[model samples]
Target: MRSRIVVGVSPSLAGLQALRYAVKVARERGGTVDAVRVWLFRPLWRDTTATFERRVHLAEAELLIPHAFDAAMGGPPTGVKIEPVVLEGLTVQSLVEHAGDDADLLVVGGDRRGSHLLGSGPVTRYSVRHARCPIVVVPPPALAQRQPVDALLRELDREIR
Candidate 1:
């Protein structure tokens, strides 16, 4: 059972799915979920306008946590503890660094709609290859449901066998 789980969250549907999945796992495993949102702001020059834009971007990134949490788990679960973290850096790098040595699992969402390859976004792809802890990539709900229930069951049974 995972004791500490880290989840990367954004405003996308895939991010919401990852959050939802992380909450469920934490509830079942008696663990805490660390919801991390990474923001990147690159300014060509350091000026008042650039600083103002950075502030605005940071504010928006901070707001995304609560909104995504609410949309995903219907407002953070009362049964599990959630810690929201807002960090400034590249999404994949930030998440990987956050996972560090203590986290037992890192949860992220796959971009099923946009990716033509593995249906995974850049963050998910990078995390899978570089994360220190075990990673769980939750596919978008629509993509998960694309397969018929019977077919899914059969596949599960075969895996079990």
Candidate 2:
């Protein structure tokens, strides 16, 4: 059976890279891609839990969903059907909840900028640790560049072939 890949998209490099790579893998397997965009906004408490704040925050989040969808799926890989889902909550928490059932694989992008020098910390740990399905961590496009050793090895392998 073809794999069903689930990817979480945030407004960051890590999330966007994952979406692109997920589309690529899904095409290879004749699979489907579910791109989830999470809008997390909690009203500040200090008597600011007012009705206006709640409504406006939620509205802002909802509006972002479509824009995020377009950004994530605009040039998706061919033969891979992409579906978008927008969820509101803690990004990691929502993704964990999504893992309860469905989807054979979970794909997420690695943060390109740091908690220590590079990449997102909370996101990486949360995904690799808690996801029920196998998680694929895709690094940024910059990481896609071929290393010298890797290029040499590929050349050798081609000669053997």
Candidate 3:
């Protein structure tokens, strides 16, 4: 059976790293990746203008998924299938809810700017506690870049073959 991986992404470098990691895992495991981005629309009142603003935010979030994917992987990988999902809700709750029973894995980016604690970000911490499936928290760019490029290339080659 094919694996299903869910990745939570945003515009940040860490978010890019998470998406990249998800793509790599999907390629290696012969799985499909669901790249999900969540946005919250908080309006002062329930008016037409507020509704329009919510729509705008949803559109921007939808666009951000592909933009982040392209920026991270130089366009999606050739073999792996990636489905972009834009959800309206809280970040952690949305991700956890989306990871439902079908997902084999959930991938998310850690907040490097936050305190130096494991799963420091609320989303990461909450996901660790709430996600039903296994969760992979990708380190921020600075930490991830420290790994040698040759190792990553070798892994990529292995996956392709």
Computed on alpha carbons, the lDDT of every model, listed in order, comes to: 0.85, 0.71, 0.87
Q: Between candidates 1 and 2, name the one with more favorable lDDT.
A: 1
Count of backbone collisions within predicted model 2:
1
The lDDT ranking, best first, is 3, 1, 2
Q: What is the model-wide C-alpha lDDT for candidate 3?
A: 0.87
For each of the candidates, the C-alpha root-mean-square deviation to the true structure, in angstroms, is 8.3, 9.3, 9.8
lDDT computed for candidate 2: 0.71
Better of 2 and 3 by TM-score: 3
Tens-digit lDDT track for model 2 on 30-119?
Answer: 998877766666655646466677677667655654555567666445677867676778877887677545778888777555223234
Winner on TM-score between 1 and 2 is: 1
User: What TM-score, to 2 decimals, does candidate 2 have?
Assistant: 0.68
- For candidate 1, the TM-score is 0.82
**Model 3, span 110-154: residue lDDT tens:** 876543446388888898889899988887788554546898899
Off by over 4 Å in 1: 113-119, 143-161
Measure candidate 1: CA RMSD. 8.3
Residue ranges of candidate 3 with Cα displaced over 4 Å: 113-119, 143-161
